[model samples]
Target: MTTAVSLQNVSKSYGEFKAVDSLSLDITSGCVFGLLGPNGAGKTTTIRMIVNITVPDSGSVYIFGEPASAKLRSKIGYLPEERGLYKKMKVREQLLFLAGLKGVDSKDSANRIVTWAERLKIAEWLDKKTEELSKGMQQKIQFIAALLHEPRLLILDEPFSGLDPVNTSLLMEVIRELSKSGVTIILSTHVMEQVEKLCDEICLINKSRKVLAGRLRDVKSNYGIRKLLIAFDGGDSFLKDDSLSVERFPEHYELNISSVEQAQQILRKAINAGAIIRKFELLEPSLHEIFVNKVTGVDG
Candidate 1:
């Protein structure tokens, strides 16, 4: 596979603080790559550099195997975290103007706008002023604006924000379809559940540094299965064991155990305490758990 984007020792700083420190990444073409990090971890700064909005103090950024340049911006579609749209402008007019900036022909851009608006179920809002729409509606419009030019590399920052569950699912489906059509996407968001479902690979940064980067499945496998889930009805004495670390959910209990032997021991204890076990299974660590552990330095 071709490398869609590459960064070599890229670093960016603001006065006394380093926003990104010696970062390096290689995103494959036609893949959904997750750029994940906690707040103020430089995820936004890194993206700004990729789109040529902010230049790195040292190192380099390459897009589609070429050095980053203004001409290459035409191939990239960026939906920034901070939404930018003319509130007073009508939806159709705003989209057309933005598409024109990308050098998309007016006729072609208008047709594409209609296609995306219908596909996103926002066609009815085309004639309405941007300010009259809700935040979710505005988000959909911004999303359409990004797609008007049919960019090869799409970078979406918190694309699911402000969307309800139904709209979120709709957007996720659209993203999957876009990926299937061979569009490379860089998804930057703090929502780990969505990332787990949508991303093929992920790079996690903390404090402006790379902490984890790999194929999603491989990253999880490397962590191994360190947790177990048990559903039961009876005495909860086993959960109080000092040797066991546990999280209590409404339907089940998640226990962190090191070995099969330890899990078996807990099962025996639960049964002995008159607990009727309905479900007991060893589970791989979830992306959410991994994110928490890595960000907090608990995994180290």
Candidate 2:
């Protein structure tokens, strides 16, 4: 497997503050890689280095194994968090400008503009001024311009911010299709659920440093506790078993057993309490939960 992006010992500081402190990460080809962190956690700084918009103070950023160069930027599509387009320019003209900046020819650029605009359902808005469009409409156009050249690596910062759920799902489909066609993506967002659904792997950053990085499945599996939720219609005293560390709800108890055999024993204990079990199920730790656990030391 080839790497689409690699950062090694990358560090960026602003006077007394280090925005990105010794950050290193690898994003492979043909998959969505998530950069998960809270605001002010250096995600945007790292991305800036990747795109060469901001040079790293003491590290290297390699795009496709070459030093981050302007020539290689054409192969990279970036949708920045702050949307930037000429407010007075027509959508089509703006996309054309961006395409030309990336060294795309006029005819081919126009063709791709049309194709992407139509696919994004903004074909009719091409001739209109960008300022005339609503925020969501403007976002759709910006997304088209970003991908008009069909770049192999996409760096999207908070791509789902302005879109409604319908449009969010729509763009998610596009991202998935891009990945299926071997376009590597580096996504940055605070939305953990989106990462859970979209990312193949993830690197979690905290206070300008990587706290976790691995395959998504491996991260989740390793971070999980095999806990179960059981709703039994009785007092908490019924579940005072030595094998289970059970917590009680208003009318039921959530049980945690060390093993599957212990779960069976818990079930029998519930029955012996002369209580009816309502909802009994295993619970998996969500990415949001894991993140809070790792970052805040709040794992329970």
Candidate 3:
């Protein structure tokens, strides 16, 4: 139950623009915490403060309850949205350089590099210059560099960007393993599905302010079980119900019901309309829907 990262009333501004306004959030130790928001929502600014890449104008940032410092940064691994590595340097050499900055010794650093490279299936490309690799390949290398020191805390901004599904799955498996081994992770990404899968807790920011923060289950549950998924065959006439807000899929239709009574009415109507019901269930609001609801003021 210890706090891994804390931002207390942190604020950052660029002249006339306030990038982060009194933003405060606590990320628990040994869990994946999703830092979510739409574009220009101050997510990157907040993360920059966490890693001390940019100092906050006011308030404070603490890692493991201590002030953020250069020495402390050795224990923190940060992967920014922009990929940075020596284009002319070999993969091994670049990783070694990054690891050295974190105070990792050559012997241990090389060992971890080998381990991670092999695990990520990038061992074959270690001898290749970074410029020779594909974007997805480069992303894997960045991931390896981030963990080269075996950091206790990992902050990844848009980690899955430009990755093919195969590589994305590979990275996700490693992330899950890291979480299981008690490494605290702060994930900032626009991918809501990934957040739903990986994050235990979340803090949503909007226009440089905190709009939502808490356990994911509790947050979704608070919105109530208003979503319904129904699979049917034959007629599509049942979808004409004006009271229902519907989203169509090839195999099913997702409908918004006001209450349990409404759900029952929907089922009866579908049956009466000659549609054979194959599946019917009540479901919680998705993080994507919740985020859209909070940030855009649209019904989730």
Candidate 4:
């Protein structure tokens, strides 16, 4: 597979603060890549540098094997974290104008806009002013605008931010479809569940540095399955065991156990304590758990 995007020691600064510090990563073509980080971790700055919106203070960004340049912008679609649209413009007109900026023909843009709006269930809103739509609806409009040019590389920053569950699912379905058609997607968001579901690979950054980067499966496998999830009724005495470090969820308990033997021992103890186990399973740590651990420096 070709390298869709690459960063080599990219760094960006804002006055006295360094937004991105010596970051480097490669995103493979035709795959969904997750750019993840806590707020203020420079995910947005790195993205800006890749799209040439903000020049990096040092190092380089390459798009589709070439040095990032303005000429390449047409091949890339960016849905910024900060949403932008001409609020007073009608949806259809706004999309047409934005697409024209990308050199899309007005007629072709009109056809595509209608097609996408219908698919996204916003066909009736085409003539509605942008400001008249709800935030979620406006987000859909921005998304359609991004897709109008049929960009080979789609960079989505918090694309699901204002969406409800239904809309979020609708957008995820569209992203999967785009990825299937060979569009390389860079998904930047704080939602780990969505990343776990959609991303083929991920790069996690914190404090302006790369903390983790790899294929999703490989990253999880490296962490290993040291967590056990068990749900039970009756006595809670089993949780009193000092050897176990447990996190209590509303419906279940997640215990950090080193070995299968230890897990079995816990189950036996739970049973002996008159607890009726409803569910018990040993599982690898979830992306959310790992994200929290990594960001908080507790992964070690």
Query: What digit string (tens of lDDT, one per residue) describes model 3 on residues 161-246?
Result: 99999988889999999999999999999899999999999999999999999999888888754799999888888788666689
Query: Which of the two, 1 or 4, has more lDDT?
Result: 1
Supply the TM-score for candidate 1: 0.92
Q: Write the per-residue lDDT of candidate 1 for residues 128-196, one digit (tens) a residue.
A: 999999999999999998888899999999999989999999999999999999999999999999999
- In model 3, which range of ten residues has the least summed lDDT? 236-245
Candidates' TM-scores?
0.92, 0.91, 0.91, 0.92
Per-residue error at 205 for model 2, in Å? 0.3
Best by TM-score: 1
Clashing pairs in 2: none
Per-model C-alpha RMSD: 2.1, 2.6, 2.3, 2.2
How does candidate 2 score on lDDT? 0.87
Candidate closer to the true structure by TM-score (higher is better), 1 or 2: 1
Writing each residue's lDDT as its tens digit, candidate 2 over 136-242 gives 99998888877877899999999999799998998999999999999999999989999999999999998999999989998877764667788756555667657
Off by over 4 Å in 3: 231-241, 247-252, 265-276
Best model number under lDDT? 1
Query: What lDDT does candidate 4 reach at residue 196?
Result: 92
